[model samples]
Target: MEEYKKRIIKAIQYIDNNLDAELSLEKVAEIAAYSPFHFHRIFRLIVGETLQNYIIRKRIEKSAFYLALRKNLSIKDIYHQFGFSNHSGFNKTFKKYYGKSPSEFRKLAPENFHKIQAKQSKNGQIDTVFDQYICNIENLLNWTNMHLKIKVTALPEMNLAAVMSLGIANVESSFNTLVDWAKTENLFPGENVKMISVYHDSFKVTPPDKVRIHACMLLDEPLKRQQGEVFPEIIEAGKFIIGSGEVTLSDFEQCWVSLFLWMKENNYSVRKAFPFEIYHTNFKEHPEGKMAVDFCIPIN
Candidate 1:
């Protein structure tokens, strides 16, 4: 069973690394070292969807993020980037899955979707209701299985070439697409580009599939205006208590729990805006076992 789980993860990694390339179920199954037929059964039972369906959903979600955030890229370019051969096929598949044409969905989402609507902090004060119940960090570290150091800092306003997606079922793929978009745009000239995730809700209340992930690049100049969309907006300047750590992929939940516990123990109220996970180190350059991230929590 343990070996099967490792195989499944390997299969997922392959799909993630080669989403734009031609991928077949047989090929993916072979990577898992399982017979194609048995692999299909095990994959569906373990991952809850057929491989093709999962891939399609990931592509659609990624394309939707581009449409929402980057105004310069046309629907055609976006479609082709995700491996769709033509615009017509892309449109048809997207409409079928999302129940609206891409253009229409983009136009209506800002007004209709609860997650898309931006709510400014009331009176510029952070809400501390959740902070009341937090136990001390020393106690939390001793009580919890994971421990990490945290620092508080003020972040200045910065512009970002961002791709925003709601109800992101597959974050790894969505994030990879955003990184690719950033690279294609030449947003990171000679400097290292960090990946930031802005969280709007607590993990307990939000399912992983329903989480909002914003992949962003800090920029210097204002973006050139595109024809009919909004460019990157300023991530407002504020005080944030930042948590930095390296965790195995399987231990991500514990990393988050430690951060939340720290925030609670310190009586820090969270701002009801996007919380960003800033990627300080490039994964391509780092060792496979170590992934570094800075979880930036807006505080009062």
Candidate 2:
């Protein structure tokens, strides 16, 4: 990755880890090693939103996560945890984006946890990934054909050369670029190179418009950046329930819905962390033009 993207990601990670705290633009910019003015423009260009907006959205989303999953937490606990000044302000913002008050959303969310019907209004849009995933998951529960060999296991740590893109539409193009860069660098020391799409946000909770997809190639070891938008990132080892099977492109959403259903049935709680898809064989290379993939979901 270029120096700028690397720095921006550093800043973003910091923000994500500290959403409850006050995030001054100057401090965030300093973390990115850029001036506030320069950082503001770059953040908007790359992340598709102003720094403050990003922070606020993350805070609201985090609050929603607590409200939906951590029922032990009260409304005040959720809002205060995210640094809201008062219940009124939090309610105002939550209603704007979710098209419903926090209390009402909480009441409706239990029957369909991770299936909240956030508004798609352009004036108050959900993140792009959330929208795409919502469309993918229409009638998801009705899907009973999903099947695969799935179990929780430890995934070994991996270091990858990654390229990020927004939306599902652009993922293929970005991944192709990363693949070309990796091949040119002769970094494929082993026959098997892991192709991964690392998801930063869960669609179930996040509103649509901004979806982060990092197309990555597993590297044997870290190598200096030579070219392209490739940057280094580490996926820590964790317990993830993985379902492996062949899925047609059209059935992709069904597969995920089925996996989540299975996870719920087996008494696994989803965590706020990265989940991923591992491609065993290229879809284009498959005999039936299907992707031999492993759908992995993080669990607590």
Candidate 3:
């Protein structure tokens, strides 16, 4: 298990460093010193998805966040940043996951972007109410020596209804269940919607079977509270280190370890809540080989 863990970490680092270059599962497995056949199975058993699915999800998720926050960037520029060889390929992938063209998602931001009003406590200290920590890669111990450039940012409060899973959560299945329930209940308003997973355990110490996850949403209106169900709650706003790239499930530990190393080295502290994952792409529409999710790590 320890040996597998090391190989997984190396694979994640390779993916992070080569996002803009051509990457193949077989090649990535080679880097991990595993045969493609066994590697693919192990990766899925650990990560819950195939290698290609993980990569596509990370690339698209990264592009989506930039599209939302960096309005000045062009679609073409975003595509190049993720290593799409041409505009057509990027558009197809983007539309498949997001349910809209990049231009469409950008256009919705003006009206749909939820502007969070910064809150202050009467004590005069910047109400650490949603105090968030942001860590850049320069401070990370594991990747500090690597040449990657990374940044961290603070995110505003969001409203969501979530289903809590106490043990190893089948995230893909749980997300589908939530969406189906939301659709049946009209939770999605056709404006942009976000799917988030709040993590309650340190990925490092928590066994995959013992991890907890909350499937949540970013909503504007109050949801009809359900009996025996967790209600919509405000995720206190905070700082987060937002990073993107693909990694197999087996490699998830390395990705998280790298993030935590960044936090510790940067003098930032982790919030007690579990980290949340945002799905920027529509998985149902994308080919199974291509899917993306964005990870948001809350900081203090």
Candidate 4:
């Protein structure tokens, strides 16, 4: 079982690294040290999809990212870069999966979707301007980079001082605001304090306007009652899958994907408790763009 997992992971890594290049079932199977016949069946059984479907899904997802992020690139160019044969083929497949064409997906970006739509009425002026500041991620964490290893462990109950945000698209800003508030209130007593962020709902299942999350710090003592969004809470003791790694803004979602895939492959079921991130270092201060964090998901 373990050997199968390792080989599948290797193939996934090969696929991710070479997405821009030609990726054939034979090539991937070679990377996995399996015959193409055996590899195809095992991949479908383990990953819950056929190898061809996985490749198409990945290509589309990456094209979606380029559609939003790379405004200067023509839609045709973006599809070509991802190995799609032509524009019509890409358009048909993209709309089938995302319910929109590439152009429609780009216009549907949360930051400028309405603005661009309104502008189209008068002068036909559109915001082809790509904003890096836009939190344009929608199901972007399709899969992980395959380097993350998930560990299952038991956690004791935690008392936390939390600052929460509702309906915010940029989660990092919320986290930073909470940490700033904590510092302003002299909440940090020592260097060992654990920083945590509770993800209350799945991005796919919940409306973005109704999404809720809490940024929290482990409290050694009871916090005085406050009237604002920041408050006290407890995380109950439970079993969890923990994946720790250095993450940047670009790959953070992929880390979550890794854990979710790990859970599926290992036959572990997720519990109702919210998945959370535990920060091991001050992310803002990291010299490298990456931050060290343990992605924690409670499971039965």
Candidate 5:
């Protein structure tokens, strides 16, 4: 990868991880080891949005998630948690995109969960998490009803060799590239190898066409040297809520939805880490083309 592209992606990872905190462009640029003007330009060029706009939209999107799913927090608490300066400013911005004030949005969340509506806003991402969450969750819920098992456990950290794939359209190609590169380095599958897709952005809050993922091969052997677009990433050891089973290609998204629903139903809280999918069986090689996959979400 170009050094600049890598830097911007690193900066975005930092930005997304700290969405609930104050994010000044100067500080973010500094973290990326670039001057503010240079960082700002590159960020917009690569991410397709101004830094300020991205931060605000991300904050709003996360706050909306909290509002809809986290019932314990008051409206004031949600706004403050997301770094809004004042109640009025948050209300104005939220209403412009969601067409509902914070409280009104909270009130409609449950109803929206049951009956999803696709309402677009100026922002490329859908204005609310409910639209995406509801769409996926309902399908999973209906198919399995109360039968799906969600397991909460602490897992050891994993090292991954990966390549960045932007947009869902390119994920398969990226995975193929990752496997080919891994083979060249003598880093191909061992007795047990996991194929993972680490999601860097939430599909509920990001536009479908622009979602980012790292197509990864779990390292059974330590890689001697790593660099470039195909690189190494560590999925930190932590408590995760895992839902695993044999699923078809279309069942993948549905299973993720079911996991989130399980989280909400059990009153579990999510943490800051990225969620990942681990594939045990390559669907392409299966007789019925089904994969034994695990959908995991980090939790507090």
Candidate 6:
């Protein structure tokens, strides 16, 4: 099982690095050191999707991101970047998956883009709260230069004391709640405490009501899980891209999105490990009225 996991990680890396190429089952199977037939079977068992489906999903995801970020790039160029040989095929497939054409999606306001991303249909139904949140996040991203600095480095394993929240829509409230808890437990600003948050679901893909966020503290060593309230997770050692800055509470969402888009542009593929933040200073005590935060994304 361990060997299979290692090979699968390599296979995923190969897929991401060559996403623009014509990837085939046989080629990827060879990369994983497995027969094509066996590779297909095991891949489906492990990934819950066929190899072809996974490839197409990743390509479409990248194309959608390109559509959102590279406003000047033409649809033809975007399609070709994802290895789609023809416009019609790309258009049909993209529209079918996103419930709108690429051009249409690109033209949507940031708020509508969020609604559409959350899979809300355009049947004249409006979600005011969702729209407002997305608009706020987009405004911050547009106002700031998100890609200030990025460095890829090797990271050692880390253990964290964490508090998990479900369906949290307000960052300030949730963050304050976590901080208050840490303070109550006397866990704040200890020699080993580094405040961070682990996002388990992407807002673009997961519904707002289903999102999971883990507010955590860096621990010198692992701690036993305390059932529901607090738990421990080992962040596996891997290659990671790090981005740091003085950012406001609102900047967290924008920072993460920008980091991922940067990764795509730089040809780095994200690994399966959970991405997290590393806080350098207290959120409430930053002299600049912003948190000094470092975003860490696992990658190859």
lDDT of each: 0.62, 0.75, 0.60, 0.67, 0.76, 0.69
Model 5 over residues 63-153: C-alpha lDDT tens digits? 7767766777889888888888799999998876666788988898744543333356566634543443434455656655543466899
In lDDT terms, how accurate is model 1?
0.62
**Model 4 CA RMSD to the hidden true structure, in angstroms:** 19.2
For 34-137, candidate 2 gives per-residue lDDT tens digits of 99999999988877789998998888877776676666679998898888989999999987667668898788665465445455655656421222334333
Q: For each candidate, how many residue pairs have backbone atoms clashing (under 3 Å)?
A: 3, 9, 8, 0, 1, 0
Q: Candidate 6, residues 1-300: lDDT per residue as tens digits?
A: 546644664676588668889899999999999999999998887656789987886677667755764556788998998899998999888876666677876776232434335455577432222244444544544543544467899988888766555455644455665567677767764775687788765567445654556777777768774433455667889999898888887777777766765665577766656788888877678666797788998875
Score residue 300 of candidate 5 by CA lDDT: 84
Ten contiguous residues minimizing lDDT sum, candidate 2: 127-136
Candidate 2 has an lDDT of 0.75
Which candidate wins on lDDT? 5
Q: Residue 52: error of model 1 in Å?
A: 30
What's each prediction's TM-score? 0.48, 0.82, 0.46, 0.50, 0.80, 0.54
Worst 10 residues of 6 by lDDT: 124-133
TM-score, structure 4 vs. true: 0.50
Q: Write the per-residue lDDT of candidate 3 for residues 132-229, one digit (tens) a residue.
A: 22333344344433522336887777778775453465666666656777786787645678777777543322335535567777777655664233
What order do you get sorting by lDDT, best first? Answer: 5, 2, 6, 4, 1, 3
Q: Point out the higher-scoring one by TM-score: 5 or 6.
A: 5
* Tens digit of per-residue lDDT, candidate 4, span 196-262: 8887544432335434577788887767763244566678899999988777867665676557656
Which of the two, 2 or 4, has more TM-score?
A: 2
Q: How close is candidate 2 to the true structure, as a TM-score?
A: 0.82
- Candidate 1 at 217: error in angstroms? 1.7
Q: Which candidate is the best by TM-score?
A: 2
